[model samples]
Structure formats: structure tokens, C-alpha cells
Target: MSPTRSHDGLDIGVSFEFFPPKTEKMEETLWASIKRLAPLSPRFVSVTYGAGGSTRERTHNTVARMLRETPLKPAAHLTCVDASREEVDDVISDYWMIGVRHIVALRGDPANGVGQRYQPHPEGYASTPELIEGIRKIGDFEVSVSAYPEKHPESPDVVADIELLKRKVDAGATRAITQFFFDNDVFERYVERVRKAGIDIPIVPGLVPVVNFSQTAQFARRAGASVPAWIVKRFEGLEDDVETRKLVAAAVAAEQAFDLVDRGFRDFHFYTMNRADLVFAICHLLGLRAKPEEVAKATAAA
Candidate 1:
């Protein structure tokens, strides 16, 4: 049997993504989500960086706090958008100094917003590949890069996107977490193409638990991903019906994941959007479980 096929024939590894919160309430909520999901023993959790270093301080603080507070390994996102080489390196060094060994390096989208043209800082790393090389030069940080299974919007073709990923791997990226897609076939084909091109880094499929139709649609637009019409129809008319939406969201996401697992995908990275309920539910469906005592603690707190 393939390594991905388990005794129960279900692929098992999972990870999560989180963004630094902007307020006290948001911070509390974020920690709650973290505490709830931590019991699942994710491979590692990532903290996202803001545009143009807007949340640089917040990202740093959140990551540092996570390092000090939890057993969960934290991966900090670093981008070559507005910071100079010296500035970016200083940030990387700070992460290393603080014992954060994993980094998600990217040539971030334009700070103005997606669809706006992206221009690297005149004195900074020019692309994700360059950023990966810089990260490797600075330290032995295990780096992750962004992959768009459907093709990045900036790239004229999927081939271009795959070539860029090849360069990222060649430049020392340890893994590539894809931009989320609704269809599992997209990921399977993308992985096949990556392997065919001789790139061997793990390409983890990014899973976004659909929490809200409007919000997910907006995010998908910003991230250069397509939301299929079928997905839209599935969530239709549940706008105010929160409970039903949650149920449907969980089912949709779980089914997508199950298909991937059946196809031999072993690792998944969830973009939780700092919401616990749906992600937790999907993880449960995938056979994730917290220790009894841990569940009791969370339940008592709840």
C-alpha cells in the first residue's frame, strides 16, 4: 500500500493557519481557537503577515507569545513586499533568535490589494525564490512557499506558475502550501505536474472550512482562487440560518478532504480564519481526537 493509505485507509496529517488579531477581543478569540485545535496535534500552525509590514509587530508578538505559551510549533510568514533586504533579514534573524525555526516566505501581493500590480521593494528580494534563497542564507530555517494549484493570477498560465514553484523548491523551500481550491482534482493534477517537473518538496493542499458564503467568496477573490458555481448554489439561502450553514460547511469541507484522502493525500493545511467550530468538526471527521483530559479542560472552559 502507498504511504498515504493508512490502516483505516485515511490520510492523517493536518496543520493550521492563523492571522494576528487586531484587538483584545480578537486576541481572546484567536487563543480560544488555538486551544481548541491544539489538542489535535497539528503538524505546525502558521501566523500570517500583513501587507507592507502593517502587522509586522503584531505578527512578531503573536508568534513570540505562541512560542512561549504553547507546545505547538509556530511558523511565521515573511514577505518581500515593502521591507528592504536588511529589514527582512533582521526580521528573520529576530525569529531565529526567538527560537522560531520555521518560516513561510513569499513575495507578498501588493499592499494596495490583490489585482493591483505587485512590485518588489527596490532593495528587497524580488520573488519568492529570491526570498527563499535569502532565508536559507540567513539561517537553516525550514521554509514554505505559496502554490496556486489553479495558477496564480499574475502568471499568464499554469505552466508559468509551476515553473515558479520549481524555482522556489530549487531555491530551498522545504514545502509549498497551495492556495485553496474547491476541487480536489485541481490539487491532484498540480501535484502530478510538480512531480513531473522534478520538484520533490511536499505540496500540502490548503483547506478552507467554509464558514460563510459571502466572506469566503470575498477571500477567494483576494487570494486569486476560484469559487465554483456549485459551491455557491450549495450555500444558497443559508444567510441568516447560522446552524444550517455550519452543518453544510462542515459537510462540504469534510467531503472535499475525504476525497483527497481517498486519493492518497496525507497532509492538509487548514486556513481556519481564526474560527474553531467548523475546523474542529472537520478534523474530527478525519479521525482527529484530543486526549480525554484535554477535552474535559476545553469543555469546562467553554
Candidate 2:
């Protein structure tokens, strides 16, 4: 039996992603989510770098605070967009200095925002693979890069996306957290293609529990992932009913996660839109219960 099955659902690993807060109220909410999820013992909790690196300072501060206040390991997202090589390297070295050893490196969306064309700074790391190389050069950071199960919007084909992933792994990425997809079949097929290409690093399936169906559809569209019709139907009548919607959203996300566990996926990464209740409930449904911090970390690392 696979380790995922043998573990009796207790030994699987999970991680979370949070974006830095922009306000005091948001900061309160963000820390609430962090503290709530901390007990589940995620392998690492990652904070996102906003498009074009707009949230660089906030990301750093949140990560630094996590390092100072929480026992949870934090991974800082680094991007090559508007910043030059020296600027980016200085940030990487700062992370190392602060004892953050995991980096999620990416070529961020265009500086202006989504839908804008991306142009690399002439003096910066030109691509994600190159950014990974720069990060590796600076420290023995455990670098993680993005993977797209539905294929990156900019890639001509899925094969090309896998080829770029191959380059990222060759450039020293230690893991790939996939862009969220609604369909498990899509993720399974993407993993097959990745392995066939000889990319053996962990391809963790990223899960986004729906806080709102319409909003989730928007995110999926931007990510080039399709929301299946059945998922659409599940939420069609719940728009005006917030309570029902939350319940249904929890059910849908839990079902997806449980199915993946059945399929032998041992690791999961959740995009926790700064909300913990939904993701926490889903994890609880998956046989995960909060333990003392040390035991939780040992279970996660198991």
C-alpha cells in the first residue's frame, strides 16, 4: 500500500498560503487565520508576494513576524518582475539572514497587474528558472516553484509548461505547488505528464476552498483552470444564502480533498484566502485534528 493509505490519513502533509495584510483590521484577521491553522502543523506556511511585487515589504514583515512569534516554519515568496538582480539578491540574503530557508520563487505577473503584459527588468533575473538559480546561489534554500495543472496561460501547451517545469527543477527548485484546479482528474493527468518528463520532485496539489462560488470562478478563470459544471450547479442556488453557501463550499472542498487522498496524494497546499474556518473544517473532515505543536510538527514531517 502507498504511504498515504498506510498512514490512515494521519500522516499526510499539508501547507497553507496567505497574502500579507494591508490594514490593521486585515492584520488582525490574518493573524487569526495563522494562529488557527498553526496547530494543524503545516510543513510550512507560505506568504504570497502580490502581483508585480507590490507587497514585498508586507510579505517580508509578515514572514519575519511569523519567524519571531510562531513555531511554524515560513516560506517567503520571491519574484522577479520590476526588481533588478542586486535588489532581488539583497532580499534573498535578508531572508537567509533571518533564518527563512524556504523560498517560493516565481516570475510575477506584470507590474501594473493582471491582464497587463509581463516584461522582465533588463537587469533582473529574466525568468523563473533563472530566479531559482539565483536563489540557490545565495543560500541552500529549499526552493518551490509553481506548476499549472491546466497549463499556464502563457504556455503554448501543457507539454511546454512541463518543459519549463523541467527547467525549473534543473535550476534547483525543490518542490512544485500546482495552481489550484477544480477537477482531480486534471491534476492526476498533470502529475502523470510531469513524472513521464522525469520530474520527480513533489507535485503538491494546491486546494482552494470556495469562500464564494462566483469569486472562485473568477480566480479559476484567471488561472486557466476550468470550474466543472457540477461544481457550478452545486452553488447555483446559494448566492443569496451565505450560510448554505459556506456549508456547501466546505462539503465540496472536503470531497475533493478526500478523493485525492484516496488517489494516494500525500501532500496538499491550501490557498487560504485569509480565512481559516473553511479550510480548518475541511481539514478536520480529513481526519486532521489539532495537536500540541510539537506533535503536530512531527506528524506533518512524518
The lDDT values for all models are 0.87, 0.89
Any idea what lDDT model 2 has? Answer: 0.89
Q: For model 1, what is the alpha-carbon lDDT of residue 115? A: 85
**TM, every model:** 0.93, 0.94
Query: Which residue pairs come into collision in candidate 2?
Result: none
Displacement of residue 103 (Cα, Å) in model 1 is 0.3
**Winner by TM-score:** 2
lDDT of 2 by residue, 182-259 (tens): 899999999999999999999999999888889889988998999999999999989999999999999999999989
Per-residue lDDT tens digits for candidate 1, residues 1-302, read 11222347564888899999999999999999988987677788999997656599999999998878776789999998888899999999999999999999988889788789988889988888888888898899999999999888889998999999989988998999999999888789889999998989899999998888899899888777888888999899999999999999999999999899889887999999998889999888888777555456545544
